[model samples]
Target chain A: MAVYHADALVIRSREYGESDRVLTLFSREMGKIQAVAKGVRKPKSRQRAGAQLFTYGDFLIHKGKSLDTVSQCSPKESFSYLWSDLDRSLAASAMAELLDISTISGQPNAELFTLTLTCLFLLEQYETSLLLSAYALRLMVILGYRPHLGDCVECGERLQGERLFFSSEAGGTLCGRCRESYSGRMVRAGSIAFMRQLIQADLSKLDRLRWAAWMREEVLETLRHYLEHKFERPLKSWRLGNTISDGLERHIRSLNGKEGKEFE
Target chain B: MDFLNYPQPLADLISSLARLPGIGPKTAGRLAFYLLQQPQISQDLAQAILTANHSLKKCSICSNFTDQDPCALCQNPQRDSTELCVVEHPRDVVSLEKTKEFKGRYHVLHGVLSPMEGIGPEQLTINLLLKRLKGVQEVVMALNPTVEGEATALYLARLLKPLGIKVTRIAHGLPVGGDLEYADEVTIARALEGRRQL
Candidate 1:
């Protein structure tokens, strides 16, 4: 088996044997590959920490016919902060899920790889809900799913200062006149501006961008609809996030003696 | 009637054995042949599997597979109900029980929040756990120290903390009887960061 090196992100990991792990990695060179980290589940295993999810590292792997084996791995950026908080951890998991589903195996996409790393790094520093929306929106741009932010998809009319409708089916924003013929969801104008700024600006500077509750809901709603329309199924992690957050919300309301608030 | 021209019944036995965890096709065939050589042992094995399947049921309170309702751990009045330890699997509950260090009841989640596997809070026993936390003062999260474990612990903490209950995670660092030199940098750092002045 020939030994090779790759700078990779640990996208997913699960227990294999009594003391080993199977990792799905997205590397700069290899798009996505499943490799075994032998004995990494052992407490004394040196590669245990590096084999964790969202860990970015330089890995020395032995190429095998069926599945590659990780011989040596040292962390360059563990992205520990992602796991330090609940929201960030969920956001990172969602990001990993998206990356796993969107990319093809063994087909290098440098822009997508960089986008994942940047989003994971930024997830640690920004509001998780806002940052998650931004990451999803920007990811769509990289994968050639960039929505029409400029003109209405139907009549190609300029969509400014008017109530805009975003149709996942129509593939972009629709003008008031064009929306009559289509069934796109109404998107807040502020959310459109925020998304435009988010996709256009440097991710590191996104902290300075103003994010509102309405923006979070609208962005997530539109992006999720577009993703489902494009990908044919809703992202599983996104569904998991909504479930947990909804449970948390209900739990909080019950604790506050405000059961059945009836607020959507 | 495959398997190098084996009989149909023998091939079916091998195929069934191959479906078990950790058993490959070759090992399954070997095991099937071995069982054929030891008829009494094979009968005993079959009886055992049937017995286990017929008797075992998940304890409604803790969700651990047990022969009895409210399993031994849940029925034990000696265990403190006020201090509950939540774990990911029933096997985890067994491991913690072996330690004999915990004196609290357990809530087995059966799984963690693994989105890739389609496991969410609803899939786990999270709702049951939340409902069971009444009069509970503290919840000790004893999930494994993986990304999913961290997320579940934090998620539970977020939900539990708001109910005026103290949420704590089992500290993960160097293992017992482990040398500091052999421990990884991350483990050592986590250990030191979580150190208490004793």
Candidate 2:
């Protein structure tokens, strides 16, 4: 059996046969690889921590006939905060979902690797929606789908307006003349600028930027359409995140007994 | 040529059994041969599978698989109407009931929120649980200790807490007879988080 070790991130994990887990691990050295972590679901299994979702670890793998086997592993970071909260965990889940759908096995992008690690760590301290939107925007940039933001994707003219037209199909902001060429949404200038800043910002210093509720939501929706256009399929986690947030909002209002005064 | 070269009917049986969760082709062949050797065993197993599949329906109140609408547990007057225990599956309800400690009725979500698996709140019975929460003071979440399970529990807590209902989760910790030295940090942290003054 060929044995090798890599510092890996558990981007996705699913239950396999009894007490076993199949892991989609992302390592700077190996890119993405699928391996079976035998018996990780068992209480005594030492690999349990490293096999968890969003965990960063050093893994020793034994290459087998079909699926690689995880021989040994020790967690470097569990991103444990992601597990304790609902929204943050779902945000991390979205990151994993994007990576899983966007990347292929055996081709490693080191910059994307660093971005994923930095973003997941920052997610522990920051607001989930803004951080996740920024991560998604930056992720697309790193993946070479850098949206043309300075000017119209079609006409190549710098757009200056209170509200700008953005098209996922056109791959960026479109001028008033080019807007009619593509069907897209009318978005605030601040939202487009926020996305541009997110794409250009350093990953390590991402939290330095404040979370603007209006800007992030708009950017996220636009990016959602952009990603679906690029990937040709909507991500499950992205949709689930919206559903959860909407449910929570309704729940919060009910708890506060926020109702009209007709009853009073 | 295929090994064993079984007859068409035998091959079909072997292929069907191999499609089960854990059984492999070799195990399926072994089982098929064993079944053929014992006629009564094959008949009894087929009858059980058909009966279970044909008769079982989700209970109206809890969503647990039962032959009757309200299920025996829902019909029982001993169960606390003021409290409800929510779980991911009917098997989980059975496991909790075996303890005989929880006096409340159960609402099975049928699944936890697992986005990667394409499972969400819509795929679960969360709406049913929400509608049934009237007159219930507390909803105790007895979900599994997995990531999806914890997330589902947290989501439900947030959803139910707004209705003036006290929502709580079953304590997640080291298993019985599990050594402290072998326990993972997540387990240890949760155990400490849920620690009580004794």
Candidate 3:
């Protein structure tokens, strides 16, 4: 078994056997690979933090007969903020999930790997929804699944600032005429432009984009439909975020019940 | 190959033991061979497993496994009901009870919010916890500091906040007696942020 080193991100981590973790890593050198981190679940294991989900690390691995074993791992950036903040954690999980489900093993895509690390790192600083949407759109572009947002896919109709629809089936924006034949979820023209910019713009320019609540909800749903439709699998991580946030909203509604009440 | 393997009956026993968490085929084989060699030990162990499985049921109030319906903690009048400590597992309830500092009763969640593992809120005992929180002044979250555990605590906090209950999480920081140099950044940061004034 040959020993190798890779700068990797721990995307998916789960308990395996006794005191071991099976990690699906996205590395610059190895692409997406599954490795077993031995005894990391032990109380005193040094690799516990490094093996956690969304941790970016330098890993020394030994190629095994079946699975690769992580002989040594040191977390360069654990993204601890992402772990503590529920909203950010959910967003990061969705990104990780996208990378895991879409990509195959041992085929390196430096773009996707770098995008994932950037998104995870910026998840602490940026609006989580925007970061998630941007990452998803960028991921699609990188994987050659970029949606047609500039013009109608059915007909080469230039999308004007009017009644527009996004059809995941058609793989892009649909005009009013196209929508009559094929149904697409009604979305604003601005959201289409926003998504276009999100996909095309560099990662550094992400902070400049103005994100609204309406944009977040609409783009999130639209991309979710498109991504799920393309992958033919449900976005479990995205659903997890939505449902948990709904719980938070339920709490807010309860707090709003005390109208005109004195502050505690 | 057949001769190299254990006999059918022994193989069956080993396989059964291997299905258990943390027990591999090798350990299971050792355990099975030991059981077969000692008839008294095997009989006693089997009886103990069956008895524990048959008798111990989840407590009606807290959902912790117990021989009684309400469990000793829930039934104990000396324990305070106003302060409720919510934990992810029955083992967590045991750990907290060991401290003896907390006189309040506990509510076991059975598990955390792990979506990657296909666990949703529906898979947990959240509804039961909400229903049983009448007159409870505070809900203390004693969950792990992992991503799933944090999300579970946040979800529960939001779901329970509508009831006008005060919800707080347990302090998670650098472990006592552990070297500062060896502590992970997450733990150290959390400790710094949560530092108390002397």
Q: State every prediction's TM-score relative to the real structure.
A: 0.91, 0.90, 0.86
Model 2: per-residue Cα lDDT at residue A162: 87
lDDT of 1 by residue, B1-198 (tens): 257478889988998998887677898999999999999999999999999999999998988899999799889998898999999888888899899999999999988887666777778887678667766899999988888888888888888776678999899888888888877767777898889987
**TM-score for model 2?**
0.90
The DockQ values of the predictions, listed in order, are: 0.49, 0.45, 0.35
For A1-264, candidate 1 gives per-residue lDDT tens digits of 399888999999987856888999999997898899999978788899889988999899999998899999988888877666877787788888888888888998898899888888778778887778778888889898888886887788887874578889888898877777667787878788777887888888888888777778888888888887888877888777887788778777675664223221
What fraction of the true interface does each of the listed models get right, in terms of native contacts kept? 0.47, 0.47, 0.32
- Predictions in order: lDDT: 0.84, 0.84, 0.84
Q: Once superposed on the true structure, which residue ranges of model 2 sit more than 4 Å away at CA?
A: A176-183, A208-212, A249-264, B1-11
Judge candidate 2 at residue A135 and give its lDDT.
Answer: 84
Q: For candidate 2, what's the RMSD?
A: 3.2
Top candidate by DockQ: 1
Please list the Cα RMSD from the true structure of every candidate, rounded to 1 decimal place: 3.4, 3.2, 3.8
Cα lDDT tens digits, model 3, A16-52, are 8868999999999879989999998765666778888
Q: Rank order by DockQ, top first?
A: 1, 2, 3
Docking class of 3: acceptable
